[model samples]
Target: MITAFLHGFLLALGLILPLGVQNVFIFNQGATQPRLIRAVPAVLTATLCDMLLILLAVLGVSLIVLQVVWLKTLLFGAGLVFLLYMGWSIWRSPAGVSQAERPEPFSPRKQIAFAASVSLLNPHAIMDTIGVIGTSSLQYDSPDKWVFTASCILVSFIWFVGLAVCGRLIGRFDGSGRWLLWINRLSAVIIWGVAAYMGWQLLASA
Candidate 1:
């Protein structure tokens, strides 16, 4: 049981630790409007979505997902577009814009919508949940699958909450405009990198 839990934890980390669209967006929100108090809702929504997908994967729906080549391709393409658009938006935003320039507080509905969009529209999330995580779960014993799924869900919740809270803490430092600028830049780069990798995979599979 201990070994199973450790394996599950590592697998979950492997899926979630990458700098994907969701992570980048969360980080941006943290840096830009850390005080909005909506970050918790956003993170919680994302974690819940992740748990749902993981559940689907564990139930063997992932096999169906893998068979739909065109659907996967379309999702990947959409993700690429989203990443590029976000990257452009971040790059074009004023580097020194103060928190005063930030938008009004995000409502609960808006936070949930943002989280759902990030998860649903991201091809990598699908692949990670439906392909990688699903495949890993199959390697475990039947009794251990539940343990694995639980660990993955826990990891999602912990990571997102920790990231959101840490971002708020970091954003509290005054005169950190340059640091924020670099984070935006880094987020943009990570988005592009993931897109490029996905494109390469799509081409390679063709």
Candidate 2:
């Protein structure tokens, strides 16, 4: 049981540890506008989306996704475009913008919606949860599968909460705007890198 739990945790970490679009956005929200109560909703929504994907994966639905040729290409193309757009947006935005200038404040519901969209729109998240985590869970028994699922859920909750809190802490700093700009730029670079890699993978497979 303990080993199974550990395995699940590792699997969850493998999927979530990368600085993907969702993570980058969460960190930005946390670090820049800590006072925005909406950030918590966003984080929780993202976590829930991840849990849902894991559920689908555990149910063996991921296999169907892998079997489809056009679906894979479509997903890859969408992800590439999304990541590139995000990167370009971040690159174009000025980091020194005040919190007041950050645009309309998100309501709690809207924050969750935004988070969900940010998480679920990325096809790679689906692949990671359904393909990678789902396949990994098969090594364990039913009980172990539960343990693994639980571990993944725990990781999601902990990671998002920690990220939100850290962002708030950073926002409290006086010169945080500069830091936010740097972070945004860093996120752009990471997103572009991921986009390039995904494009390459798709090309190789083709």
Candidate 3:
């Protein structure tokens, strides 16, 4: 059990530590929102989405779904489209340092939508969850499996909250908003790069 717990925690932490579209979106929300509380919707939505994916992956449901060729193609296509649009949206967002020049914060609805898109629509994230965590669970059984699942889920929740807090701290300290502007631009580039990679995969699979 201890081994399972440690394995799950370490695996989850390693998988999530990478910089990705999902991470970028959550951090941007935390930094751009007027208050940390305003970023709760994004934080919660992303965490929940991750929890769902982990559950599906561990239970082998996602593995079964991935067996369908058409579904895989569909996922890649949809993910590519949304990632491109999302990249554009982030890149164009205003980076005003002052309250007057700053654009309005995203409403809870928009935050939730974007969070879900980044979480669920990205083929790379889904593949990572299904490929790594899902396969890793095969090493355990019964109560141990459940323990592993719980550990992974717990890591995800805590990590997302921590990310939001870190972003908030940076936003609070960066009075000039120059950092935020660069962050947005960089995030957009990363997202677009991911989209292009996915597109290449889609074409290869074709």
Tens digits of lDDT, candidate 1, 1-206: 67767888998998889767788767667656647376777888898889988998888885687578888787777766766776666666566656554433346676677677778767668767877788888878767888888998999998887787767666667353666777777877887787788778768877
Worst 10 residues of 3 by lDDT: 97-106
Candidate 3: residue 170 lDDT (0-100): 83
**Per-residue lDDT of 1-206 in model 3, one digit per residue for the tens?**
99999999999999999999999988888888889999999999999999999999999999899899999999999999999998998889887877555534679999999999999998888989999999999999999999999999899889888888988898878788887888788889999999999999999999
- Candidate 3 at 178: error in angstroms? 1.4
Look at candidate 1 and tell me the lDDT of residue 131: 76
The top-ranked prediction according to TM-score is 3
lDDT of 2 at 171: 64
Q: 1-206 in candidate 2: lDDT tens per residue?
A: 89888988887987898877788878766765648465877788988988888887887876687679998788788778777876786677665567544423346775675577667667778877877888888888788889988898889988998888887777667353666777767877987888898789889988
Q: Provide the overall lDDT of each model, using Cα atoms, as 2-decimal numbers.
A: 0.74, 0.76, 0.90
Q: Which stretches of candidate 3 lie over 4 Å from their true place?
A: none
Pairs in clash, predicted candidate 3: none
In candidate 2, stretches whose alpha carbon ends up further than 4 angstroms from where it belongs are 34-36, 97-114, 121-124
Q: Is candidate 1 or candidate 2 better by TM-score?
A: 2
